[model samples]
Each structure stands twice: as structure tokens, then as C-alpha cells.
Target: MGPLNVSLCMIVRDEEAFLERCLASAAGIVSEIIIVDTGSVDGSREIAKRFGAEVLEFPWSGDFAAARNAGLQRASGQWILVMDADERLLAVNEAAWASLLRQDTAGYYVKLISYVGDRTGGDYVTDYACRLFRNDARIRFEGMIHEEVVTSIRRLPEPEGIIRPSPITIAHDGYLEPVLARKNKKRRNMDIIREALRRTPDDPVLHYALGSEFFQNGHYAAAAAAFQATLPHISPREGYASDLMLKTAYALRETGERAQARRLVEKAVAHYPDFTDLLELQAILLMDDEQYASSLLPLASALRIGADVQRQYLYNSASGSGTYQTRYLTGLAYERMYRWEDAHEQYEAAIADRADYMPVWHRWPVIALLLGRTADMQRLMYAQAARLPRSAWSLTANVWMNGQQTDALREMAERCEALRAEATVLRAVALAQDGADGQAIDLLLPAASRGNSGDALLYVWALYMKTGASREAAACLKREAGGNPALRAMAGLISGEGAEVREEAYRLCQQTLMQLAAWDCLDALHAQLPAQLPYPWLPLHAMYGYLHAPFASKRELLAQCTRRFAALGYAEQLAAGLLALECGGFAEAAAWFAAAGRQAPDRTAPRIGTVHAHAAMAQEAARGYGLPALSSDYRFLSICDR
Candidate 1:
């Protein structure tokens, strides 16, 4: 491998913070660095110059693919390696890149390991994009936001180096910053996406991109509609349909239509059973349905499909998405089924196959701890802690799993204080949970006083709700709702505020439910709040308390609850069973857990805890349904518990 000529191509704008790092990482490897500046007032061009990159000033083009194609034209190397400013060349893949360039592969499909700041490790949301292609092969780019290099890649005349499943990866630290900035970037992107949509209404790819834009921007309703609009126009072309269908399913799920989403994915899988993207979707849906057993089939299929590569795969050029992403979903599904061993195996495999992935390490021990594998959990926690800072989520998990309450509590307090008001609402709940109500009250009251009072009131409400002060909680909510329109709307629906209020509440709930966790009711108050639309990133039931209310027949509610339980995945089955218990279906709810205990593939602690909780509730019910002696007339309420 004697100094193989490599062209380092990139399109950038205001990437001064990362340009030097990126260039330095590829310094010796690249024969030429072709930098296409898309309007940089931040001296990004100067920085590129410092790194000896050939900086070309291209007027800001709305099309990312076009800008990239322009850069490719400037690249004069035997092989072209495309990269992003915020991405770094990982040390792990250094050898792979060096070796592959010497080989006769068509092109190498490099992996991306993305990291979100303050989290544990890299996200295993891996994808294989043709980064290294023979320059004479003439690969060009297409599309806007998520552009393509189809034209240029297609020009490669020979069966050149095509590396499909190479161990090489680029470390993506682009998301390792403030979320507000990310949101702002996405907002700008939405403008372009909206423009694109207007120009091409019938394009499924555009529709999918717009839907993703909306989803990322916390605009679920619009996102869902975009995806729905693409449904009739979904491409049935062999490989492409899987990608389109998967995106649609995600949009569907985020919009609260779980059943419909599942059906769409099922159809896609039927057409392409081994499609990794569709298989990942199917696995997620199955996990939601608490059908852990059912999920195994598709997940296994995805892994097998993803791992089976004959040789280096090349992308000559297609305008739409050619990359597939599902490592996160598969690893997550394994954990949810309580198969800690399998979960660990998958996470490691995903990372080994793509080490630039950072997030998988964040949640690895969650399943390990759930399975009572304390030693394994500890080992992973410490390993993760070493790789990340003390404030990172991985380190936090280590403290939490090891029962280092003092340190974890202190760390959480710092984090809560560091976050803005909207996020501070959650800090209040954590504080309250840790028996620091005084501190919780201090952190919540000032923010709650403002009109922006999100779910802070809910934390206080939870305190009252837990202490058997329903009337007090109701009264407090009324006052809070009176002051804040959003709070009022939510209070109206849950507490029967008024007709106008209930309608408003429903709209808000619909908007915000996607960000909320799948199982908890307490966290969903933000969604149900009547304020403008709730933030889409807010996790609902996963963090909040929900009361299903009295049903006409326990059987119907039980069935509904069972399906709901199944749809959210087995990790939440316990929560669903609890709801079933509250709905007066004690035996059925208890039986659900009993079945789970036997059938669950993973041995996570949450599963074990849920089984115990359900059993205890069942035992309490067996003593007499925990029901008051009913009069001949049949009454459910007992003095309102005032």
C-alpha cells in the first residue's frame, strides 16, 4: 500500500470548530482535500486552507447533492473519500482504509458512528455509504438534505473496489452539542424540505424526507401527514420499497397510529422479507406489542442479512436512499425481551461491526442489570464510564446501577439546573422521587409561575396524587390551569374542565405524544397540556401517571389494555398489566405477567420487578379484588377519597 492516491471530498458551511480535526485525522491518508464551501462567514474556508485543503467557494445551493457533486468534480485521486466537517476519521478503521485502498474492491461502504453529547457512548445507528470509490469511475451526487452520489458512482466503468461491510467508520460528533442548535438547523432544513415538497408533491422520497424533517422538528401531525401522503405513491421497486415503507412506519408510529404502522410494515416485509430496514421496523412493532417471541424472527433475519456480504458493494448512483440503518433497533429489541445475553451480544456486534456507534454503550447495562447480572453490569458500566465523562448518561447508569444514589442524585440535580425551563420539569420529578421535595419545589415554583409552565405542575400534582390528596391535586391543577392555557387544557381533559378546554387538550395531546415514552402516563401531561402544541420531544406515559378511568365492562378494558401493552413492547408490559389491575381485571393482568415471566427472552431487572409487582397486586386482589363491599345497587366511588 505505497501512498495510494485518495481524494478527500466534503461540502461544508461554518464548520470551523471541526474542520481542523477532520482534516488532521485524514492528513496522511488523503492525496487531496477538496473542500466545497456552501457560504461560510465563520472563517471555515480559512481553516480549510490551514489544513492544506483546496477550498472552492460555491454559492449557497439549496441542493446538498449538487454541492457534493461539485466537490467530486474537483477531486483528483485514484479513490474518493467523502466526509462531513463534524465527522472524524476513527482510529479503528485506519487499517481497513489503508488495506482496502491497496485491494481490488470496487468501493468501500464506510460505517458512521454518531454520538449525541452528554450521553454514554457512540450511537450504533450505523449505515454503509460508499465513501471510497475509484475517481475514474465517475460517481456524481443527487438530492438536497440527504443527497445521493448516483451519477458519479454509476460512471465507474470497471468492477472496481466495492467494500460492502468493511470495519471502517467515521466518528460523527455532529450531534454532540446543544439540542437548540440542532433544532435550529432542522428548522432551516424544514424550509428547504418544504420548498422541495412544493416542487415535487408526488415524490415519495421528498415526502419521506419532509416527514423526517417534521418528526425531528417536533411537528408530529405534519410529519404523519407527509408520510401518509406518500403512502399511495410508495415505490414498489425491489430494494427501495423497504426504505420508503420503513420511514412511513416510523412516521405512523410517532403519530400514535400503532396498528396502522404495523400493517404497513407487514406488507413491506411480505414483499421483501429479508429487507433489513423493514425487518427492523417489524421487530420494533413486535416489541411494542409485547410479542417478544414474534420479534425474534425479523431481528434475526435483519442481522443475518446485514452480516452476509459477498464482497465490497459499490453504489454507482441513485438519487434516493441507498443506505440502510437498523443496528439500534435490533440491539434495543434484544434488550426489551429480557435477553441480556443476546442484547449484549447484539450491541457488541453492532459496535464491533461499527465502533463509531456511541449510544449502544449507554443502554447496554440497562438490560444487564435487569437480568440480575450485576457483575456484567458493573463491568460494562465501568468500561463505559472510562470512555465517557462522569456527566455522560453511561456514567450516570453506572452510578444508578451500583446504587450510588448520592452521586447520581447530585449529578441529576446539576443536569437539571443546567437544562432550560422546559426540561427542568423532569428534574422536578427526579428530585421528588429522591425524597427531595423541598429542592424540587425550589426548582419548579419559579418556572411554574411563568406562562411557560410545562409539566412542572404535574410533578406537584403527582405528589398530591400519591399522598391521597385527589381534591388538593384537583384544586391545584385548576389554579395552574387558570393561569396557563396549556395547563388548563390538560386539566380540562383529565379533570373535566370544559368543552372548549377538552377539545384543545386533545389537539395538544396528539402533537406531543411521540416524544413521551411508550408506557408511562405521568410524563404525558405535557402533551395533554393546552398550550400551543406540546413539544414533540416530550416523553408522555413513560414519565407520567395515567388513569384509564372506569370502564363499563372489565373484559373490554382488559382486552384494550392487553393490546396496548403488546404494542408498547414487553418492557412496558408490566405497566400495561398495572393498568389492567386498576381497570378491575386482576386475574387477567396478573396472568399476563405470569406468561411474560415464563416467555420473556431477556432477564432484565425491570421485567423481574414488573412480575413481582403484578403478582403482589394479584395476591392483594385475590384476598377480595381490593374492592369495597358493593351495595345491591352497585357503586364504585367511596366518598371521592377527599
Candidate 2:
């Protein structure tokens, strides 16, 4: 145990991209490196030699196991540790390494984590492989692809207790989306499997391999057929049994055969009742069919498996995911079933596991609102907002402003104004939105003087969008906007002019209007719009109002907007106009006005959208507010007037 005698054995081809890191991680751990190069045209051979490896050349025979076996033959250590070039050995203490190799074992089932998305980190699959084994002539790898030495080691006498689990871990990113697209390894693997299948047509493992290759490349129908073909021949005792079962179910599900998938995984879990992956799959199948209550049984079973058990068996673990992800999914199921308190508990559990995960808490404010916990919505926003970096202040404030979370947004903006100009612009925007133009202008005038504070740029935009600032005030904004076409679009919006819309300018204008949270601004932008820009990001629902709002669905949203506007005390005309623009058609509104026979809008029938008809009412309604003098596009100038 003074120094562990370990040989790092690997077969690599054109792996120059990943070789250096792989060798470096194993540098101090392995005594020697045995690399079998399979016709590499790149610097794989040169890089291997730099690491002092005894490189052996093997002509491309399209057989992974044969190439690997050749490398294993050159290993001259008491213990052989096999790895792939795209994998890295996780760092471990020297004492731990020595203790692992000193164990009384023929081989060790090492933990293998294979990432499936971005290599920086995302979802992954994990499993155990007998990667470290005693160098024996009888113990060699087999199979054309998905090769392993476990079957060979099992042939030895009393093999059951000899191959025990170990703490050794290796991370592999070869299967990540970018690597898979670049390497096209799936194509080569499928070709080898098909050739081997011709030689042994009845081999279940080969059938499983073919199915796996098909699954990886997204050929679900073919994968499903191949997986079905392997079922009768597959043994429950095989290392791939659980994965095969899960992949088969996933393939069937992808091919629009969820019923078949449910039946298949439901049957498989009977054998692996304690397997977390299979149990989760069973629950997922139930959830997909909207049998959410019933799905809880399997989810509860999956949760009961304990963390150690969860770690021990991650077979096809992409479905198993992680505890937090599973709990998040469970929360969705409860939410769909209208079990709010139960769903809240599940979400709390999910967030406990991943408190700072943005995706998990992305809509938590809305969730609190849905639960009728207004105070909780404020609290959660404050908590998440407090943790944001300085760079995120404006964007986050813009998001809150656009969403019309008035109290929270104004509070955060006011708090941030003292810290930075970018945040100060947000405060100015908040004031302008609330009709406090003089106070907002005072804040923006000095902010705009400080050269290049992006905060000042938006402060100017607020002046143009909300405050009806004089020419002198707009000059500071013009200087701040520079030559950006998107910033220039606001001039046309406020001046009653039209221009062909550029995508950037158009998006900026749309976002600015939404951020203002003013119905008149939103309505004027669309009403005087030069033409519809086909940008996908354009909010058509916000643009055409109830024109996009399905006629049947406007009642609730109208009620909501109405009550919110009513609470402000000075937004009666604004509320009615917004209702017409957002939930009722302009032509229908005009007809309601015509039906009122020139009477004041409020004197008209209250039902059948008479209030909405106020959106296009006559001069009596337009007078005294100076609506016509401000801008031709300014439709509801009296929105804030008492």
C-alpha cells in the first residue's frame, strides 16, 4: 500500500480535444498509461506520447472491444484502471486511492457520471461500471460497443463478493449534445452494432445496443422495435436490465405509445420495486395520462428509497433525474390537480434542495399570487431580488415594471436609486409611471448629465414615454439615445409620425410601452403603428388587445385589470379604454358608443361594454384634458385626470 500500482488503460481515436485534460487528471494517480490508438489522423498519438504512454497502433476494425482488449494486454500493473479519453478521473486523496486499490477484490464497481447536455453542467445519467480489475488473462472486455469486463470477471470462482462498490468516480462528457454532434460517435457505434448483429443475429445484448444507438439519435420508432425484440432474450440479472427497461419505455413513449410505455414500466417496476429510476418512470407515466393522484404512490415510493439507495442505482438515471427535479415535477402534478397547499409543500421541498436555482423560482411571485398570499409574493420577490448582482438590477426592475407588480417594483427601484444610475433610471420610470412627472424629471435631468450611465438612457426614455417632456428635456434624451434606431423609435411614437419599423426599434418600443404599464401608451403605440413588424418577440396580445384575446376568455382578465385600475382612483377612462383595447374590439367599442346616442359615456347602459365605448367617445369626453394638443397618437390624455 506504499504506492498503488495502477495502469491507466484506454483506446482512443482522434481524441486530441480531450486527451490533455484526461491525462493530467490521472497524472499523479496511475503508474503508467497504455493507450491503444485506432488510426488517429490527429495529434492523439503525439499527445499520448507526451504523457509517457506506451502507444500501440490498432488498425480501424470498427470493433471497440477489440481495440480496448489490445490496450488491456499491454497493462503491466497488478490492477488495471480503464477509462475513456473524454472522461476525467475525479480528484481523490492519496490515502483514499491507496485504500481503494488495497482492498481484497478482483474488481471494483466505480461510479460513472455521464453528462447529456452542456458539459459546463446540466442533466446527466449515472451508473456503476467494473472499471478497476485485477490484471488476469481470463478477464478481458467483450462486445462490439458498450463494452465491459464484468461478464469475464464473473466467470472466476467466488466472484460474487470480490467485485465490491468503491468511491472512485469518473466524469464523462462525450455524450453531451455538442460532443455528440461534432464526433458523430452514434453513427460509428450503430454501424459496428449492425455488423456484429449480422454475425450474431439472436444476441440480446446486441439488440439492446442497436436500440440504444437508435434511441440516442432520436429514431424512436426504430428504437422501440429494436428494444421490443430484445425483451424475450434479455435477462433480469444483466447489468443493463433496468436501463433497458427504462429506455424501452422511453422509446415507446416518444413514439406516441404512452399506454404501452405505462404498461411496460409498470410491469418492470414489479421486479425492481426499490429502484428509484423505474419507480419515477412509473409515476411519470401516470402523470402524463393526468392520473396525478395515482402517480403519487410511485413518487412516494421513489422518495422512500433514501439518498444512498438513490445514489447506488442510477441506471438510465436521466429519467431518475435528481431529488429536487423530481420534487419540482411532483409539485406541478399537485398544482394541476388543484391541491394548492400540497403543491406548496412540494415546491418548498424542491426549493430547499435548490434554493438559488432561478428556473425553480422563476414564477414564484405568480405562484404566491395564485395562492392568494400577496404578502408572500412581496417577500419572495424581495428575497430573490436582494441576491441579484449589480448588473442584473435594471433588467430585473424592467421585468417587474412590465409585469405591473406596482408595490414591489416601486420599492425595489427606490431602494436601488441611491446605489447606481442604472437603478436610478428605474426609479425615474416608476415615478413617471405613477404620474409624478416633476419628481421623475428632477431625478433624470442630473442622471442624464453623467456621460454613458445606461441608467440615464432609460430615464430619458421614461420622459418621452410617460411625462410629455418639453423640447429642452427631450434634448438630453436625444443625446443619451445616440444613434441607436431602437431608441429613436420613441420619437415617432410621441410625435404622431410613422416610419418603417426595424426589428430592434420595434421590440424596444413594444417593451417600453409594456414597461410603462399604461393602457394609453400601449394603445397609442399599436393604434398609430406604421405597420405590423413580424418579429416573433412582438407581443401581439398586448398590441391588438382583445383582438388577440379570445372573446370568451376576456371576462376574468378584464375584471382583474378593471379592479387594479379602479384601486388607483383616477383611472376610470384608462380602465375602460384598456378593457376595449385588451379585451374588446375597437369596432365593437365604437358601436357601443353609437348605441349611446351622444350621451356621456357613464350615462350609457353599463352592460354590453358601454364603458369600453368610452375608448372612442366624442369631444365632450376629449375636452378639458387637452388630449388633442399633446400628440395625435395620445388617445386617452385624461387617464390620470380627476
lDDT value for model 2: 0.66
lDDT of 2 by residue, 65-114 (tens): 89989988888998899999999999777787888777788899888889
Q: What CA RMSD would you report for each candidate? A: 12.5, 10.9
Evaluated at residue 440, the lDDT of candidate 2 is 71
Expressed as tens digits, the lDDT of each residue in 1-642 for candidate 1 is: 233598899988988877898988887778889999988889789988887889898998688888987888888898888999888887645666677777776576676766654442533244557676767535566667777554355555555424445677787766554633853676677878777778876767777788767765668778778777876876576234455567667778877889999999988778776566667667778887878778877877766665666533222111111122355566566555544566666665554444434465555534443344546534453454434433444333332423323333344445433233445655555555455656766686677666475666655554554444668668766775676776676666666554344444443343222112112233334233343322322212221123322243234434544444434444344444544555655565566655545555453433444454455565676896664532211011110000
Task: State the TM-score for model 2.
Answer: 0.71
Alpha-carbon error at 13 in model 2, in Å? Answer: 2.6
Q: Pairs clashing in candidate 2?
A: 422-455, 546-582
